[model samples]
Target: MNKSIVAGMLALALAGCASQQPEQPFTLTVAHINDTHSHFDATDARLELGNQALFTRLGGHPRLQSHAESLRRQAEAADQPLLFVHGGDAWQGTGYFKLNQGAMNADILSRMRLDAMALGNHEFDLDNERLAAFIGGVDFPVLAANLDASRDPHLSGLENLRPYVLYEFDGHDKERLESMDDAGDDPVVAVIGLVLEDMAEISPNLGELIFEREVLAAQRTVRALREQEVKHIVAITHLGLERDQRLAKEVNGIDLIVGGHSHSLLGNFSNLGWDQNEPYAQVFTNQDGRGKTCVVQAGQYAQAMGRVSVTFTPDGRVSQCDGGNTLLSDHAFFRDIRRAEQHRLAGQDAARVAAFIEAQPNIALVEEDPALRAHIDEQYKPALDRAYGEVIGHVPVELKHVRLPGADGQGSRVAPLVAASQLYWANTPAVQAVTGRRADFALVGAGGVRNSLEPGELKEGHVSLELLPFANAMSIVSLTGRQVAGLLLEAINGTLPEGAHTGKFPYSAGLRYEFSETSKGRGYLSRIEHLADGRWQKLDPQAGYQVVMTSYNASGNDGWNTLYTAQQVLTDRLDLAFVDGRLTAFPVARLSKASGGGTQVHYINQPLECNAEGVRCNTDAQAFIDYVRDQRPVLTELTPATVTLNRL
Candidate 1:
């Protein structure tokens, strides 16, 4: 009775076996850069040849152009789809950035022709209007999915930026979709963007614009892309390698993350053999705990451009992922890469391939883009020469400014001196002549100082780029001795971010203090003395004192709210402040505006121009310049620093 049924089942099984279609492999290649940070041209760097060392320039807009074009050609020859992605932070960190305010970067990167980029924290360095202007300029999509910028007039009406973008593969057909046809086989890739969440903490200009958590935003963006039947989601993020690693662990559906902000060297490298950077791309398991995610970053300042090749099964699961950083400082690396690919495709034997690699030149010069080079050479160079070439002063030895281990007491000694420089700015007769009140001490933050100086030369350019790249100006504020003491404690005991040091350590003027780490939380301030009557005596915590600090610190958004004099004056959290600029302590507004029409501590964003403007402001670099030029003949090396817990 079952013979006919068995025969029927056999035929059905054969039909099923014959109808099954093997999974087609989807291949994609992404060439990416992150933390481009406005160092538009290559600078001199130590490069490693096979067995020799050479100092040469590496990376600039032009080299990137030529290399990327070569990469595109290679990808096409290999029959792989190629994408160019940027991970963000193309703002700040150079004289070009200061002079042009990211205009050059926007122009240069646009010329490089990016497909997508995430919004970096530094993009908000300027006002929203400026950021909107930048967004208006980029031809490719500028993406930030965590925040809703539609309500902000400064960011709304921008056509170039969006939450996500869909990039259809080369063979995509519009005719297939227009006919109401069931063409579910379109090769569409979705790229989502994520901006860093700590913008409010790092810079305060974001102002009332709220950012959603990264995981939630990612989930929603992925869901939306899935709804549109888009597979192979790539999250281009400005959240740095550390955050990106956490993201890979937490989020699903993202095949890759091209990241920035920490300026991490991900994957492979060439150079003096920077051995510390992570391999060009790090692989992690997928969210379902089965598939894989590849995370890559192009080192900051365009030192390298990363290329990642990913293969996905037709069902949108990752199959093979290979990536490494291209050290643009040396074109030889890229040439070898091309050669290796050519040989592999040509079926060259391993011995022949190794011989070919050995025969390749160790050093290859990167050709400059002529027109851009001329503009930089003739125009930008001349401008820099005029402004920064002047010898401002000399230093006996290199002023110590390099960041040390977190436990090191002298994290950045020049930072303390930068703090001391503020005293010279505010205590001048100009302030007494105009405001009738002069500042007694000043605060300089260690985090704001960017570079260290060498022993030989001290140009205005040195002060400009190293000391004041951020262009933060002075803010005069009022504080009591207790407030000052509390500020120091805030700097020393502020909550450290994950894998970050406490950057708010105050470098002071006209005062010295001592405290112990063991006794910090129990009672941090052991003794704080100020120079009174030319003698170092106990600082009166109750006595009112005038203080000057950079507006970056005064904004109360530098992750050191307790250091803000307003918090001490009003005894309330910064988040509780209203538009009226008063703190609501115990649900009551207690802050009274100073006589000059600002906060109780008198918030002034302008440079201190006492005679002409009544009040004045001095940028950090300018203050360093004026102080070194006028009072100090030679900047000297640091005296040995006792540990902070011993003496701060």
Candidate 2:
């Protein structure tokens, strides 16, 4: 053979060997969202930057939709395979979603093309049947690994929806498939969905028709998916970041965990900095134990979208994973409400979405029920109307329950007046005379004053939902003065300075306290004095004295745990007993008979005391007017005056 022929053959063999080598790895992108608690509009007024205020910009559904579209387009143009997924809590919160019962929001989400979502606890706020209707309304799969929806006849039909889904795709950048060496490699991916177990306790209404198991249910599902040769596993969890980190550390087959629930805007897999009470996890690992699983949540509402990109080798493990959270609101910019309003008004003539909602079908009651709802409305509506509209005293102008910083601010008048009224009602001879048989102390939480009245022309028949939206009726409960002070201290300690002064402290008809607004939460109540000896005195926490307060305060609704331990000796009284009745029942032609006629607020110089137990009070007033009306037969009065309001 010739030497030239041998050399040409060797060159041909080398070229063929180089062409047989493996190609570059394929890349995958997962776009996730969670805890979008129906923050459809920009409601939060106080915002700076980087904080939750960023949400105020792109929080709306329209802005969020536009952002998602742009990102999807960008990913497609880049030749990347993008998957859109949601962790859970797609609805509830705010008057918008609550009034509509999630129907409109669900429609918007369906248009958003959410590929998959986990069933959140808020979904059940409308109950089982409505949830079934909502699930049917959405095109995407709502998966919950441990939810046993078998008992709900409306949900049992969805048994085909698996706890996890396995997707096998030809790995290629959607834009430039030809640029990648392993563009045609097929990789199998498993996506599992997990719901928080505590949802059963917190959102009992949503989970009442179903039961949730722990992470073990997810483990079993992952094992099954792995058995089918699906190696790249991603768990869309509604169990929050802590549980997600814990699951990643404990679970063996999970490749990555997309977390939701405890709405933290997580950017990386490290220490969670915002929460101070608990220790942060040092590190979080992926399914392979050695690798790290990227966990993230896009805060609440559709404020932002999570973008995660990971490269995978021919084997079932992940390779270079890189991505960052995108603040979509940066472009939408909802901060300038005036600008948004202009834009929104300009777009009002635009075409509406082409969708139809069928008329609601009503279910007829099978049993003949008594007029319970009517009875409740009839019993409570008048009391609410009188409390909101009736003129308790002769005010120079109208006063409102809430106040803003300005000349028009009347919260001061309303607060002091109401405080004085409750104090007088509790200690009046009639109230004291009935102490052994009924509530001795009357209390009111500040948040209960749902709405405020306007100056001038405030008239009758005005009170409605705005007056008391929470359905929290005024109530009276008996407690010792020591217990009362302890409760107040606890509230003052837990509340912000402003909140402690205006809303945290329980208002009582028999007690008074002088607090400084500049003091920190715990030290806010610098001097607490009760009215006695025609004067005020410092309060002692150990002394026992009878007291009365509102039901919300006594029942521990607003972090008032101290009240719960105060020994509830009495309750179940009409909300208007002391204040409304006193203002209206006064005989005509008398000074106290006129509106604003009851105990007027007058700041005192020192503290006051009352009772044999040496109970004391540190407050702005020395004496509270007693309106007991002889403590015998309960005096009843009816008035025609009422107040009205528009809640928006």
Candidate 3:
């Protein structure tokens, strides 16, 4: 044995060990908001503070900006890398968007210093040209890995509309690392965008664009980034909280998901009178049963912002994750926001409420960002104020809107009213003249009605611009009782599954049904009835009836494909007719040969005049406004519950 040979071999092994040092762990801070929906002004929310029900204003864009900027400053002082992002649905909820459209959204969000945002379904509420204009105006990149805009002339050339983006952080300063030259080695984290795959079914204006499957897109993008040596991956998604969890379970290498669309308030808000018990930063094991992914979502309408701190191992697995939604609120407290002047809290009550908010880790009383607030007040708000100022009617009590029926079988208190309005408007002489038939019933999905009807003066702005903000035209569809029953069953079944989207839950006027989740009977629908001559009777499967709904529903969006198919069949033999100096089209269901080979057509479900008239022809909103105006002291009862859940 040679001593010199042994020593040289030992030195070589030591050198190899020195070169294989363990990679240092990285920690990233993230601030996120989702489903903002153009709610720039503070919205009223009731919280049980100090054992008293108090009304408080929750997060608006200004408050969100102020809190996010503060967080940015804090992270900078601590030398921690921070990324601010939105989970999408930043358009089309309030009067601001209704009046100013996506321009206002781009202006406000661009100032928030966002890193990236997912494309929400509402972003396609208008045409692709409008969406492209919005993307051009925003400073941050809009992402959608599943979206293929190559065929869209308006969106194909936008450089900032990308599938994913990479960010490199310097280890020493914790600042974003950028290359001075064209080539760079690798980035620290990759932010991937994922949206709903069936976006076309839900959003009608997505012209010449395509959406791929969400899970597949996410998997492919994550793999691509991993191959590029980018380990830490965060997916900003608009797939809702339930789908986000599913994505986390199915995808590998994803560390965290910031989500929207479900508008889930994920945190323990039981103390605040909210029954939200879902854990923030919810963790799920990857598809390969290795690594972990954390999910978080801020509630809808800019009511809260989620802040999460994630620590990644050397191999990019999520080691430790922590955070919750921060509900930004104002200092002023009231017993009832509708009557603030009469219900103001004072002295010990006010102090106790303030103390409670201060003690909560997820609640903060923050001042609005002065510049953004001033901009909103001066630039975009005046026109909205002036246009929506007229008082339409008054209500004595608030009508609540719940997307799904409760365990006790109680559904939304507001959506049924909206349905009744459509039925009322359809039966009017002006509307019936064009259709040549009266509407037997009306159906409205829960998602169509955005907000609860507050108890106070009902302004034109609240109904037309906020509650039913989509401005969808009213549509009448003629279908047999069998088809009507099938439509209800399809909608009910779509929402009955676990983690299903409850927005498809149907609320109706002049119609009622009993549904059982466990029943094998006709898609879980046990019984269905329609009101006729103030009497409720079983829906005859063969009887023909005219159903009124939004044009969005008639076109078969949002799990209502049956209606779309039925309308399409009738549309094949359509005819145009002039009634009262107005031109309208109707679906011709039957054609008979008259004398001399002339054909006579039978019309059904006349298409309302929506084009040219603009938002003025939004009969869905107009109907509700007219109903409230005609029926003084608006209806407050939720009785004759449209849906009954039979648990058997």
Candidate 4:
């Protein structure tokens, strides 16, 4: 009520705002989401805090929309420029993807009103035609500067894709980006798209497309943009954090890098030894050593959004940067779990628990947007509801699967579940119909599996969580016992790209081998055995056998390339053939169905076109669902008879 006090308070607030401003600065706010992976609805997310793992609800499209809207409002109130960008991989994780291959995500993301998105590796999971179609339906620009579309007829026109986009904004809304309160001449900002170079190795869908080296492609694009008088360049990149950092240090002209693909969590920079929790924005000196380039990647699954506030000089050079992740730690549900843990730790004390719960930090969670929630209820819930209840099988015990590093990030111990399932499908009569015999063993790459089945009841929905993210068809391949040994050698000890990990470590079923982490190259193998008549027998190199595996590995993704190319394995290799349960070989059908007609196709390549009628091929998920349904309760445990023994 005191005028003098009110005036002083107003003056102090203005001073605070001005203190954050740099001379000749153009303050811009960026709201970014990445690797959403179809978590269109809220899900329980786990967090590892110091010594305790906590559960919290994270990510629903509505909540993400609400958060972004709030950012837009905040930026508008501050009279600063704001941009909403998605870092891609909006498909694959949820039942929404399994329903119609991510069509709903496209509609939902468009409704969120995103300006642009980088091309993520998982986008290629749908194959070229489907991906092209998905892009055609999206309202925003899909970016990837390094992807050469000449190989695919559908992608040759470069429709729905841009190497880069230039956008101008002001109060006048000349470019229609949005409004700035105080009208002025529109300032142009350039956004370039960069893809990971090893995309082809990761997804068979990209096998035909050529990718440019990230740094070189960026350098060339930055020069071209600079020539056009575009300043303040931001690269929307699918390159994981490491490559993005290298791109920043190796190339010049880029002002900022918004990245995805690694699902990295950036917060604390000092703990470089751990994978997550790096500083939100890493500052790197451009190659010119004149200006700084700031790189940021929001952690995956739409669980968090990265907010970046940048102050740029009038000359279009970055002057200062600040921001961090806004995690949606909903206390509504997870608090109950916390209470249980608390009560267990301290003997049952209702009053104490109540007091403790009340004493907890009142961190508010973002509310889901009503409109988006309504849209999901109307358009998505029906299918999702059915999927959630559809039974797949029963598990005798929990099959734990997490990306926890074993052998110091070499691989995960949980990979065996994926391998065992692959072997199960391979031994099926459908597989026998093709190879004229049942598969003797199976192998799968560690990274291909997204999650492990928990103990108890399994459903079609659970399958989506465990294995659907890949969209990789199941398949069988015939190889001599010698080739199997050679493949194992190549996987563990071969010369992988610098910084590439053995996360694609092989997990074999019906075969056991002992290897030490200390071994290198061919020396990695110590002892190996095969299950013959449920008996462990020494692997005979001369014998022939059928193997089941993900189509991803069969097509030579990760380190599988070494196994077949004679680079790190035995000299001879074999050809792949297409087979079905009907004892028929549809070579042409398989070509069009899986690997897009590649030289080597996997046995379980699914959603295929089998007959002239154009029937949809069975997907790997379907095969798994069917296999599990028949078995009812599959026991999960490691016994002395378990395959793939690691000394580690």
Candidate 5:
């Protein structure tokens, strides 16, 4: 009587077990933005006039917000969980952010509703104090797993920012169809932020207070999330693509990595159906023994927005995935040629959200007031007066882009001119106020010259700082003529990479030399030459020559490690002191006088000397300065000007 009943009950129990199997599929969407360098304004009307209609508009927070909004809407319609994130560099770039230390940009950015953001290197461009002021009211959390914020007095309060956040979303039930759509299981999405460790070295002044950590921080963060039972993890990274990939490969449990810093336009690394053929390529993962990790980054300046859609089963394994990126600047009506694409992208009616970023009210913290701007712009007499001296001669116009004599395409043209003036000024009465002696040899590094004088009618006070604009100190160093020749050779033969050649190396107005690009080793600089009488002559390696140069050069910053190798006959004299006591007195009058009437510069290929006897064949005054001003035209002086130096 009991056997049939017992068997029926067992059968019912087995069927119930089969019906309880876990759900096998789920979908999530990720929207990534990076490197929005505080460009607030939109297009200019003048740019809209001509052929400007052909190009695409680019960058503005509002455009990015709009793109993000569009992505969110699509995700919501598709019944997917949407996560909006940033890769970093939400700091200084334009007059807007720089004017307020990112306060202005942050105010606008906070309103965009980002879930999480990584810290880019430029975030440290402002001191900790300004950084705090800038990010004080940010709504969303910033994740920087690598920055040791405790050491910095200015950044000490940043410890409150969460290192990562696990977002929980309830998925809608597909079974319930339209009516029961609200019923679903809760899913945990973990997001971690990371910054590069090299920020300290790259941005010394801004990061002086904090030290950066490395991959271990990321590893620890992932482990912590794992402990919290969160399996789906996304890393918001500003450590660059290479490092991001390495992190993905080394760390287990990282589901996706959104990267920045290299300004790359990536989609999916493999054929996950993302944009594979475009110039923009998304970096993928080691595939967890399967295929690609989901890595994506929109290019810099909010020019594009990246989207990744992933299908994950209840088993925590991603089943199927597909995604694409939309170019914010490629839409119609934004193609005005005369207008700046940035402004148009920010238009109120644009597809993306409008960025209502306002200028900082505390102007004193950002830039000088109008009066100060005018003071520096119209009449910088006090600053200039405290720099150089009374009028000497006068330049009819500013002499920009000066180079060393003879060292075609390799040496500096402007440095030599300033060095010449400083050395000449040292031989006068005002010199006693500083070193109490006339200058010997002058040396100026390539990095010192910040601006070039645009060709125009030179005027008094014009020479004031139309040339130099840095903390560079004018200095006098004693060098054997042989040492001077070696320094000149090193300055001419730079060690730049393959494609990074700028005509910014080389010596100043007084020096010159030649270089061979194809030669092995330091052969980049060849047959040494200098300006003497009215022609170009060979540099005598044996003679002891005194030269005036910048302190930076002597310290070896611009690939001039060879300079200090020679005997340090003497140094540490303050060239700024000379500039102060002598040059600062006359300001306008001194600048004009020093320019002197027109100096006729010429170039002669006739080669001459290295010895005291060969001095007779030197180039003329105008030829010498001309040779030093720009080696491009002095082709025949030293080595050919076409032998280019590449940057590594």
Candidate 6:
């Protein structure tokens, strides 16, 4: 009797569902920075203005605070939802980190109020205990969906360490966008963290933790978020731009990817003397072929901030995305800051440079936050100044540190010099006597040299605090010529893929090679030679040669697997001590087991006197400083290219 009534009821219900409107499209504005790397003070930057070179100060955490506050106010006034996120790498770059470790980073970042930060590989530069301490101190969550820290003793119980965070915004009030365990019935935005799956291969201090493949972790998390009725998803990733692009293309639910790790300065900065052709916010079709994902990353060292606006459709797909990276610059400009008099830009020249900066959409003039600046000046700057203030040497010209050779066919101008320094240190009588062998060649990774050598008075701070900041122990590994060739091929091939991290690209002293990207087999590399007795000779495959490199590389991190497989590896931990009013390296001896079951003779930690006389011992930095001081106008003459690239 009720069949007709049931059919009518069903028809009415279907009509009601169809008539209901879809959820309203939401537009979100995101402010992001990546790879700040503990650069708390303003850094010198050069820009091309009006066909003339203009030197000015770029970003610092203080400037970042000021700029972020300005962006927050603007978003609030406009009634727009905004989020400030960091794409990881907030540790290990400058003297600030050397002195204060992650403590300073935690303090500054907590004050700036980041929504979330991805766990960068640099975060693992220290042990898990230290990383856990950092996580404990930060106000915001440190995310890594791919990281399984449950096995780690220190990070296992941390509450702030999470896979993802959920935010349910109420209208334009972003302050109400608090991290929630559940979003109830409201439409929610999920921020997921993804890190490199090969984290251990690059960062060696991750203790008892496991990292899942980034793609798998991201896909699984996005699917779970979607299952929970969360539509909008953003992935803050430490996987470099290339991997981020892959993540965007492979995963369907991610609406945006904020990334770091390769320190890519995305956007068009041609006007500023830097050429970056990649658009800041690039949109890609998701694996499902229907969804769209937008990817963005700010440059390193807090120099630039990325602001992106994304319009999400009712279905949580990115319908439109627009944004660019704005370099944070100080108001002051200079013709040449190195010149004491008449170098400061003033009058008409100042006005012209200001006008140029103002006209550019990607440049922002910002002042330092007074409170942060004062804190740094009082609490941190003095210690750094006292430790690294003395003038070490001078650089006649800027020595650029490009990881890979650019279109000009010139690779890292600074890395080879650094390699030369390592070689010199390895051949020193003290080091040679301890190791029982003189190093034949020295290799340094591009990533090891943190910053470029600006043409000016080089300070002790510049070397230890900025340029070569890691203070890695030096290792001399005896390898056959065949193994060295294999090492170069592996390292170079790892970086040949587009957008790959070029840090692994090798730079060497006493060694040179030609690489062909299009060639196959051994043809990819040719003319492999080592400088012997002041002459270049083809590397004999059967000959045993002692190669000097950082302990990080000798352990097979960063694709230097051949070094780990070397027959003989000797390591030295050099501590800086002022012995008889001279900066001297105090060598210690110890032993450790290598990954390839080879014995690693290294030095263990020993307390040394770091008094007023000057106790600053880092083998790499000290060697470079010593070399520069001994050899004036260092890097003035261009040497034969260490790595010659043939893209064809």
Candidate of highest lDDT: 3
lDDT of 3 by residue, 1-648 (tens): 699999999999876644332367778889999999999999888888767788889989999999999998888788788899999999988999989899999999999989999999899888789999999999988999998888878999798899987776653233333321222433367788988997866876665787899999999999887776567889999998889999999999899999999888899888788877689999999989997999999888998999999988766689999999989999888887674677888888778887888999888999999999999999988898897977877778878888888767767889988988888878878777767878899999888889887778889889889999887767776788998888888988888766677777788999988887784322467889999999999999999988888867766678886776675435432232334545354565643322311223345565434344331445677788878787644567557788786643
Tell me how candidate 5 scores on lDDT: 0.51
TM-score to true structure, per model: 0.76, 0.52, 0.90, 0.79, 0.55, 0.90
lDDT of 4 at 484: 84
Q: Pick by TM-score: which candidate is best?
A: 3
- Output the lDDT of residue 596, model 4: 34
Give the per-residue lDDT of model 2 (tens digit) for 556-590.
54556665444333322222122322311111110
Q: Which ten residues in a row have the lowest lDDT in candidate 6?
A: 590-599
Per-residue lDDT tens digits for candidate 4, residues 1-648, read 999999999999876644432336576678898889888887655443332444556777888999888878877776677888888788787778878685787899999988888888779877677788878888888888887777776677765687777677562232532222232345767777898787756666665677878888888888887776565688888877878888889898888899887788677522212254677887899878897999998887777788887778867788888887766545443333333455232334433333443443312367788999999999888877776767666666445554423434333434665566666765667755554657788776766666656445678777754465554555565677887888877775543333344446677778888765453323466787888896889888898776777655765677676444521222212222234333343221222223332234433323344332533333455556665676534645445434333433
The residue-by-residue lDDT of candidate 1 on 290-401, one tens digit each, is 7578888877777677889888887788888886776664333312322344423223343433343345332234566676667667656666566666677776655656
lDDT values for all models:
0.65, 0.49, 0.81, 0.66, 0.51, 0.80
> Model 1 compared with the native: what TM-score?
0.76
Name the candidate, 1 or 6, with the larger lDDT value. 6
Q: How close is candidate 4 to the true structure, as a TM-score?
A: 0.79
TM-score (C-alpha) between model 5 and the true structure: 0.55
Tens-place lDDT digits, model 6, residues 1-648: 599999999999876643332378888888999999998888888888768888888999999999999998898888778889999999999889988988999999999999999999899876778899999999998999998888779999799999998776665664324444444445567899998898766876666788898888889998888776677898999999989999999988899999998788898888878886688889999888999899999988999999999998776778899998989999888777584557887888788888888899989899999999999999888998887877866778788888988756878778888898888877877666556678899888888888777887888888887888886656666678998899998898887777877888898999999887774322378679999999999999999888888766766778776665552334343433345545444443544443422234344554443323444435677777777776643455347777798775
Clashing pairs in 6: 576-617
Rank order (by TM-score, best first): 3, 6, 4, 1, 5, 2
Between prediction 2 and prediction 6, the one with superior TM-score is: 6
- Greater TM-score among 2 and 5 belongs to 5
What ranges in model 6 sit over 4 Å off?
A: 1-22, 175-186, 339-341, 519-523, 567-617, 632-638
Q: Candidate 3: which stretches are off by over 4 Å?
A: 1-22, 171-187, 519-523, 571-615
Q: Poorest 10 consecutive residues of model 5 by lDDT?
A: 585-594
Model 2 residue 300 distance off true place after TM-score fit, in angstroms? 2.0
